[model samples]
Target: MKSFYIKIKSFFHSIEDNIAFYPALLSFLGFNFAMLMLYLEDKGISAFVIEHAPPLVINNADTAKTLLSFLTGGIISIMVFSFSMVMVLLNQASSNFSPRVLPGLISKRNHQYVLGMYLATILYNTFTLVGINPKETDKYQLPGFSVLIGIALTVLCFFSFLYFIHSISKSIQVNSILEGIYSKAKTRMIRLIEKEKKESPSFPDTSDWKEYGSKETGYLQTFAAANLINICKENDLQLKIIPIPGAFVLKEIPIIKASKAIDKELVEEILSNFNFAQGEIVDDNYALAFKQITEIGIKAMSPGINDPGTAINTIDYLTELFAIRLQKNDDTIITNEDKSLIYINTINFSELMYQVMVSYRTYCKHDMTCVQKLFIMIKYLLLQQTNNDHYHNSLISEAKYLYDDATANVENEEDKRRIEQLYKSLPNKRE
Candidate 1:
């Protein structure tokens, strides 16, 4: 039962970004609302409206039918146009910025709510229009109040369409995309820092533990840590998840190990809790955010694009994100009460810095603006307060590597002088 819940949660998380998710949800709500209006109509809501506020009710069947028909057509047009605009912006963003950003953009809840509003309004009006029957027109009939609500919903959708127009305009800009990535990644890093893991969890020697292989292939995007802990405690076992989130898992690859040789059935049950899918979300894995930002900067520095301003901006964002990351421990221990139940591997700070810096050194090394910015980025990380000298040492190493790369490739003397000066101003010297 727990394993099934894990798969269900992961499936929803994977599809939250689907274009139809919110729209489909709101459409169902709209259907229920229509039924509610039908009940109110049966309860003489239209007659009550006619008694208190005659002007607000729609008495004429022809007028109500015409208005509902017109609204349904108008809303369908608006929905189609709004979706097309989204596709165009998505395409433009993919081309200009990074394709990695589309998931973030697609998952914007505000936009989805607006789309859902459009869908809901359409469904509501359609249903209300269907109830305007000829045979029931003699008594307290006409579904007058329902027609009024439909009109109200149509007007609201128009306003929502206007908001969508204003929003999509600003969303396609480069700074918005960078900030979106930076914000989520920073939040993720803060979670790691805030998570309680004072004592490093010591895992039992896994040399004798039985290794379990993945049954399928995909990127291991997320895992159910709580479920893994529960399963371990219930079975009286200590387990080690071999790969971190965002790792590409292959079929038959050793993805986990158990303290004792567990049967293949239990192994499959445990593996079911891991979510393997495409796309990297910063919320699930903060490291992917760093990689995405670096890729954008590198792409900006490409000879064809040649936008050093964007490269420099991306570098500045990375610098701030790295500062947040500095406070996070590399420990990936999941504990239950005082007992440690699972060990998940995580990339250490030194290795993370090298991975980010190597790409900048390779792509942006030739450009003076990028070279100086990369140097300052490293220097800035050096000055941030942290208890870990190891993180500082990694910064120092990356800083020197950047300096050497500039010294060898940066031909301009003035640029070289500035880098050398920044290099000399390092908070800690590399011996």
Candidate 2:
């Protein structure tokens, strides 16, 4: 309830949020105008006189008193009527479903339009109360009084027309504006892919690459291989592993075939000593394969921030890859050094990825929209991931570092107290 009140207050404080204010003001204006018209009619000067002001002053004492009463009463009644209408609109419009009509009215640039309509309403109602019907005026009504009522009604209708227009304007789709933001995000993704490509090595079309086998000949594999080749070329590194026919063997395998043909004695000796099977091929590009696999897997995981389901699906995909690699007999040969760099582009990254699943879960469990929570969580996770790349190997270590940095910034008493409280709230640190 307190949070709700706070939001309501903040909304009213901003001019942009005036959608809830204008309709209310309009109703108030309308009622006030009606009362003013009533007062004008009660005065010695008929609605006709007020409608058509005489050039010469011919006011009697009684006429002056009557006019004064009419003016006072009409103004008071209009105020009351306006207030009543404002209350009605406020009660009718639910914030969750309908746009606040009152605020929208206040947002308009034309105050004169608002004033004129309400003023006319008051004049018309005042004239009517005084028995001056414009349509029936020809029978017995004074000209000015009857015409004033007609004028008031016209003003009321004009205000209504403007309100209708404003309603339509407010209802216009805002999706294009949202789409513009998404466009920037798409561009950023494309740029990142391009940058990584530029920085990475390309795969060589050697016989060794063929050893990863044709099963690797997919769009994702091609892109990953290209990235690896680009990285190698940029770094001036030797082809870490040469491509060969039929399935890539791990880089640690000592019996790789040379890029060019070598002496049979040396090839046979090396292959025989390293436990090579007669049919086994040497030029396996395990480095390229691993790097490519990890990169593609990360790309698939990137969309999980806004969508929990996407994150879960991505995690599942990476989990399969990790499991496959673990199951392979040669996988045990992947050194700690090689595994560290590869995981960033693969399954390990998902453990620290944004808790999109948690956000959706919270939303379902609680009545909250969770949009803001999801946004903050995603932003924090991205920052943490980037920082982890900067200073640490594991997610847990990076998270601890972040907590330490945050703790070090405490200066004031309030901040120190908050820090202490936060420290207490933290989970036990993993050794």
Task: List the candidates' TM-scores in order.
Answer: 0.94, 0.24
Model 2 spans with C-alpha error above 4 angstroms: 1-35, 46-130, 133-153, 172-431
lDDT digits (tens) for residues 228-249 of candidate 1: 8788988999988888778898
Give candidate 1's TM-score: 0.94
- In candidate 1, the residue pairs with backbone N, CA or C atoms under 3 Å apart (3 or more residues apart, or in different chains) clash, namely none
Mind giving the per-residue lDDT tens digits that candidate 2 earns over 331-430? 1111122221110122233332223233233232121122222223333333332312312223234334433444454445665455445434433325
After aligning candidate 2 to the native by TM-score, how far in Å is the CA of 79 from where it should be?
Answer: 22
TM-score of 2: 0.24
What are the lDDT figures for the candidates, one per model?
Answer: 0.86, 0.35
